[model samples]
Target: FDQNPLAQMVVVGIKAGIGERNSNLSGNPQDVLKSISDRHKLEPTGEPSLQNSIKMVRDSME
Candidate 1:
């Protein structure tokens, strides 16, 4: 996992979701998603908006 960027990203996304769930912060979901994306060095590539990507990530956690 340490050697693979993709794996690292998956872990980061999961952490982001868990962090958000446990925190008292409140704002648009997209803002949280953007923060996670920035942390993981992800950028929207036109296929899926950041919001959709966020939804997908959270859904996969379920």
Candidate 2:
């Protein structure tokens, strides 16, 4: 679960694995995740990455 304001903007804070895509967004969640991951030096695996998770959570608090 991501908490970054950018992640919220990335996917509008929607939970994953629901089959439904993020609300009020363009393209797919995979695309969003990949971009987010790439920006944070993650592997863009589409699944949760430890680095991305930490970055997102930490970024959100600021």
Tell me, by TM-score, which candidate is best: 1
* Candidate 1 per-residue C-alpha lDDT over 1-62 given as tens digits, one digit per residue, 9 for 90 to 100: 34443442342233322322222233445454566556666432334244545676577568
Q: For every model in order, what is the number of clashing pairs?
A: 0, 0
TM-score, candidate number 2: 0.26
Residue-wise C-alpha lDDT for candidate 2, range 1-62, written one tens digit per residue: 24443443344221231122233343455667765554565223344345555565466558
RMSD of each: 14.0, 11.8
Off by over 4 Å in 2: 1-25, 42-62
Candidate 2 RMSD to the real structure: 11.8
Clash-forming residue pairs, model 2: none
Residue 43 miss distance in model 1 (angstroms): 14
What is the lDDT of every predicted structure here? 0.44, 0.43
- TM-scores for every predicted model: 0.28, 0.26
